[model samples]
Target: MKHLTETEIADWVTGLHTPAILRHVEDCPECRERARTLASALQLFRESAREWADNRTPPVRMIPARRPKPWAVRWAVPAVALALLVSVPVYDSYRRDRQARAETALAARQAAEEAEDAALLSQVDTGVSRAVPAPLEPLVSLVSWNSGSWNASAGQ
Candidate 1:
């Protein structure tokens, strides 16, 4: 009978026995020794492989980079809108104030003009009327008044 191969011997040691190769290894001393040596080598290789697996570090998982949310842009829109809303009322108030000031100035100017007209009328009526003489004739002459005075003095 032919002796078992190393593959057959290894398989037999691991509980995968073939009957014909088993019969060969049972009768052949050289085949039996080869099977024993292969079994020992397989055991040593498995132990070292386990040790190497235990000592090895796992690969690190890299996290993907993330971008932050644009809160500034979100807030900026609301802030601008609020500013416009607040300014609208303030601008309206300022416009109203300006209009009121203009009306007040116009009223003051009209009042001043009316007062000046009243003062001119008063000056014309009082000063000009009082300065002009009314139409009248003189009662006595200088020569007649002097002759009467001389006669009275002579009689006295």
Candidate 2:
């Protein structure tokens, strides 16, 4: 087969040719090398084009035209108002419940402290009503007094 022309080679590189071009490149070393060079040049051109496009800044900025607002935007305010109406009462009830629990705990603690204080005062009264301390009560039974004098033996 005759060697492929530059256009034929280009078309083949771009996937535009038939099986004959593939056979020629396979059979002829010179045409095969030419096709490979063209393919490499095309790949370089594509990379440079991408890089140039990325580096280029747009000269004129176009503002996108806005479409009509959706139905949700119209009800946005009512939705927020409903959320607040639902949340405010729930928050208030939560705060009131916490306050009631704290008050109950405080009352119970005060009652316990008062009971402890009352028990302590009753112990003090028992200690003060004793004529003699309990440790010396046995000595009292061995001694007696009569006729304004000390007596060692009274019933013996």
- The TM-score, computed over Cα atoms with residue i paired to residue i, of candidate 1 is 0.39
Worst 10 residues of 2 by lDDT: 59-68
Distance from true location, Cα of 154 in model 1, Å: 23
lDDT of 2 by residue, 33-128 (tens): 999999999889877876776677863333454544658766988999999999999999999999999999999999999999999999999889
Assess candidate 2 and give its lDDT: 0.83
Structural similarity to truth (TM-score) of each candidate: 0.39, 0.47
Cα displacement (angstroms), candidate 1, residue 57, comes to 46
- TM-score of candidate 2 relative to the true fold: 0.47
Candidate 1, lDDT over the whole model: 0.74
The candidate that wins on TM-score is 2
Off-target runs (Cα >4 Å) in candidate 2 are 1-53, 56-69, 137-155
Backbone clashes in model 2, listed as residue pairs: none
